[model samples]
Target: MAAPAATAAPSVPPSLSLPPSQFARIQPHAYLLAHLSPPSASNQPSIRANGRAPSQFRVTSANAGSLTHTNGSAVVRIGDTAAVCGVRAELLHTEDIASWSVSQASSSNKRRRLADLGEKPTEEDEDEDPEDDRAHIEDLNLLVPNISLSTGCAPGFIPGAAPSALAQSLSHQILSLLHSTRLVRADDLRVWYQQPNLGPEEPERHNENEQMDVDAEQSATIEDKPREIKAFWVLHIDIMIISLAGNPFDAAWAAVLAALRDTKLPKAWWDVDNETIVCSDSVSDARKLSLRGLPVASSFGVFEADAAAGWRANVIPDATEQTQTGKKGSPERWILADPDGYEEGLIQERACIVVDKQKDGKTTIVKMEKNGGWTVDTEDLRQLVEISAQRWDEMKRILDQC
Candidate 1:
């Protein structure tokens, strides 16, 4: 008789059953890209979701001054992404800031300086101390920005915990961008306070506290009037991401622009007697903040021919020929501007381009960020900028309408 048939091995059931397609099972993002990618014509994506052109952005909507408490506020929506920005202005006494710097320098920084070199500061160093006075403490930190990304905005964010690294980095980036661009007028924030002359006996008053950035020759000819910035307007800008589909930077930038444009600061007067600044409560006394330029941000998702087509296509195009060692070559990428969440996940290259149209009609690039490992040529960047300019115009038109 035949040897007892080998006992059949038991089969273990699969823990999960994935989609039938190989890419769908192994890489869901690739499957999504392959199935949902826009139709191609001439090796380019021809159309996007919802019948949009490849370069077209999703519908944008903005509403200004949405919050009552804030000096200015706005809600901006870019497709499924939503962000709310609020601006609040406060008066900061220049003297107080100088004093704090001086105190801190004297107490802590001075100790560090002494400890580092094992010697006291030299006379020249003392004379050149940056914390000595208001002029030396040129703190251009008038605008403070914070970004909030709670669990409600996205699934990964934990509730009740401090903002994630992503949020903090975004916040710092926004602040740096605002400062580098000089979007707000510096002169507008300056306001002076001076005591009245007693019985018109005070000589031409000249003091360091009453100094201005006037030229030496210009100061000699000017009349006796306080031009010093005793107090300044510090704008506290808060941006909250309520919903995120993709492209947080673009949505946040739009919201910030709208809110800042709508900003109105209450008339503040420095009280010589009280040594404080008094802000007017009347809405009629509120003045609109000066805006230098409006910068619009455009985000793009880069999709390579290999990834975009995935397993669905018969042949995948590579940017460069493969080497004899069988190593993969560079990939040819197509940019999808204002990509939704699904498209963003599959993309390896992302770019955020900011453009501002000056009053004289010249368009300037405020900032451009290209992230991820994919390589983009100058021609592609030029094309991207052209699209960004067009999108900026579109965003401006929408803002103007609202």
Candidate 2:
């Protein structure tokens, strides 16, 4: 006669509305719309009682080097959502299309000068195809939002499928954003293919007595060339939703920045004489991508009823209590920052706004998408830009800690 186990409380049936299948289509968004909004300050978690607000974000943690084989890797956990990013690099030759770019010209001149200075043409170069002797160019690829939905996160999987469509879309969005922005460069990460045709009596071979002079001359030529500019690097980022708390866009952006901060690219060697490629394995020789600064996201909830009144919306960096409460929730709607899962179900309408600030102090709204029913006016858009710019510098400083 075993005692009966205590029964758990009955839970609400999972709603079929807005299923994962549909989410996959929109997850790549720059700003994920979160519908969760506290009915009032009193309805939020205890943290709000401790002076925290309903829109406040949870502690975000970042770590790197989880995977050793990848060129570079990093992980960021914002509350329950966790994302990992890995960087891999490959060396490629300059395409025939852009054979005369600045990189090609500079590398070509260096190699020719090296040959003239009497350094023995390495054996590798001796075996190179005469046609392949032309200058080399390199390109970079970055893969992101490789979604891995851990069992610990949710039971929203579509049986017999890999990642949901939402996951793929998110990954693609991040990769596209990173690539179009030129945040990394592949040309600089080239690893020379060490040509194998240099003969002992090659024209560039230096006599023993002239070895020191040749070395000096080659060094001088290399010194004359300006360092290569790396527009962006290829990276693979895997984002796992450990908790579907809501606002995937903001969490993803934070994760992307964290992954990039720790990502490293291999060092490259150029066959300056032949405008060729060379990659290095030594960490000391590798380079890092120069990010344009953090691009944070904000979202607004427009009530379906507010369509007639014209729902006002803007993206701001540092919002004050006055600004936040400038408009109250009507039967129509409201805009909020970083909404969580529960609030989404409660709201009738929503929209997301994202901003990226250039080094010159100009802010660009890279993304805007909304659901439910509301339209924004120019005056509201202008206010959002001002708010985003004001907070850009400060947000960057905090995000730099990652």
TM-score for each candidate, following the candidate numbering = 0.71, 0.55
lDDT values for all models = 0.73, 0.52
Instruction: Give one digit per residue, the lDDT tens place, for model 1 in 1-402.
Output: 778889889998886855545645578654555544645654654554345666879989999979999989999999999999999988777777846456545545665777688976654554345443333223647788899985788777778888788788889878777866667765556565544534322345587443442344344445333234577788889999999888888888889999988999877877777877888889999888777778888888877656544432224344222311226645445578898876777777688888988778787998988877435657778988899888878888988876
* Residue 291 of model 1, lDDT score: 76
Q: What's the lDDT for candidate 2?
A: 0.52
Which candidate has the top score in lDDT?
1
What tens-digit string does per-residue lDDT give for candidate 2 at 1-402? Answer: 999999999999998667644663544121122322334655753232113343455556666666798766666665555666665554334353353376556656667887799864553553242322222211323243365655656567644667777677766766656555444433333333433433233246558657666666766665554344322333456666666666566567666666666667776556667665555668897667665556665655432332223224333332223234555333323344445554454455565566778768777876666666433445655655565555455456655665
Q: In candidate 1, which residue ranges exceed 4 Å CA deviation?
A: 1-27, 35-45, 49-51, 99-140, 194-226, 307-330
